[model samples]
Target: MTISQAESHKHLIRTKVWSQLRKVALPDSRFHHDYSSFIADFEGSSAATDLLVSLPAYKNADLLFIAPDNCIQALRYRALKDGKTVLVTTYGIRRGFWILDPNEIHESKWEMASMLDGMERIGRHIALAEITKLPMDIGLMVTGTGAINYKGLRFGKGHGFFDLEWAILYTIGKVNKKTKTIAVVHECQVLDEELRGEVWDTGCDFVVTNKKIIEVEDASKPNCGILWDKLEEGMLEDIEPLRELRSMKK
Candidate 1:
């Protein structure tokens, strides 16, 4: 299929999954109207987090790279409580990346620090160059998904922020082959059909739901760094981190 056709198919899948999620997803007062536009906070999010923490990858990892999705809030809280450092991007990656170290936060504020609003307030802003200078050993990488299949193909909220984030990290050597990637979603979000993934699509090694854990065999992920030609227009101008990264590359 052509690139246009492939994208259209992915959009259809996202729309269908979003509609299904709305029925069972927990209500978010912050985004009451446009549930489809954002990743739905589905029921059993806490349960999913519980399962994720039980994994060996999570237990052994000192640093985690988590996406800024509402469903993964519980996981973030648990990570901090367990004394794990988290690397997260601002919402839509609009403001760039932040480093949330458990050592820096007060124990009483961990729960608050896990939330998006709290993360922005409490987390320290780290530039791209600074991040590269830090330790690059990320053991577990978790992201919230709009839809995923047994093959580990994942679809986000149309925007490619997560994929870009991965590319940036991979390019900077923060993420390596040993890093275990997982996608947390509701059972309803797991698709039976094989998704046609693009070259730049980032897949997961595992899919965690409230019900069970699925270990994907040979998950597909981007093998290269940033695909400069595939980036959206004005992304560099809008996201400071990207601009900083671009300058570093030059």
Candidate 2:
């Protein structure tokens, strides 16, 4: 498909998923509606998060970099309660990292650390240099795909935060071949169609929903490091963490 065709296809898929999710009525969920899309923070988010933590890879992973998304809160909370270290990034890595170390947090406060704002309140603010110094394991990434094929080909929101976050970890040698990447979304988001992503994009090892988990066999994950040349103007100046990482490369 041409670039325009691809965009139209993605918009259609994303719109369908968002519309369906909005129609869902759940007392347990808190919806965030703004811009052209909406994020329904469904009760199933907990169910899906539970499914992810139950994975053997989740148990084995010592450190994880989880997205600070509303849907991903459960994973962050569970990881901390289980004594695993979590690294959370602000929107686009603009605000750097919040290190959620179970050992450092009081047991009662694990729930607080899971919330997007709570991490900044209670967790340690980790510099890019400090985080790059440690080893990271499996990443329990938050997925916001409009649709994805069974092979785990994912097309997410237009923003490329997840891709850039993975690049930073991979570049620092923190994430290695052993690392497993996973994303949990609603079952409706799983599509039979192959919606493609850019060259710098990475596919998940597993696509999990509250109902079941699908292992992606096709390896479309990006092999090289960050796509520095492809970044939008002033990206290096705007995101502090990326800037720190770039200076290290120099």
Candidate 3:
């Protein structure tokens, strides 16, 4: 099926799963255990091993990860505290709620604060780097899967910003074989189908959800021209510093 067709199908599934989750209200204890299982499983898994073997030393590795909220996997703070350099996006208020960075949320800052705390738990030094300023040698891009509907392919609310975020990194030559891109989500989010590829979507090498870590093997890389095109579209307009940097690049 075409990418658009796949996206549409996944969108429907995501809506269904979300409705189910709301009716059931995932319990806190279950959430905690699933996250813990992922941390433990990945710690000894091939994905983790491959990441360390392939990438440069984390002692100097620049890491970019997301701050999670809205029922995403609650990654423990221990991992964050052990990293080298960390980067985070800012949260904004929308539709009577506060959404985490680059997205809209309708809730209070308390949830956002909790997400920030998880990001801080990694305890790595903060480096306010945009996609443009991202050091050429970033070792990993770890993200928490926010409401991945559509069988884990399409991202939250269809803005496609997360894929753009990765594409920006790829376009700038910051991500390569050695750079690890991992997503943390709950088990239920993993779809039973291939995540449809698109011209702009950033394909992840590792998926760490509630059940286990899924490593997408022999994954297709984003097209260079398409990636640059994404970078050219004044996509960073909302990001002030990024906008300034892009202007300088121009």
Best by TM-score: 1
Instruction: List the global CA lDDT of all models.
Output: 0.85, 0.73, 0.43
Estimate, for each residue in 1-250, the C-alpha lDDT of model 2 and write its tens digit.
8867987887787777666655542322233453133233554777788788878878877888887666677888888888899888876678887899999999888998888768888999888778766755444544544446677666667566777887887787777544677777777777887766667777888887868878877646776778888787878888887888878889
1-250: candidate 3 lDDT, tens digit per residue: 8757876876776665455444323433334433221121222223333343243333454444443333332222222334333344433111011112222222232233335443233223322244445444556665544334233343444545455555545555666645656655555555565555676655566665534556666545454422434353554555443444355457
Which clashing pairs does model 2 show?
none
lDDT of 1 by residue, 138-202 (tens): 77889988898999988777778778888888888888766789999999899986667888888
Error of 2 at 140 (Å): 5.2
Clashes of each: 0, 0, 16
- Per-candidate TM equals 0.96, 0.89, 0.58
Sorted on lDDT, highest at the top, how do the candidates line up? 1, 2, 3
Give me the displacement of residue 154 in model 2, in angstroms: 2.0
RMSD of each: 1.3, 2.7, 9.3
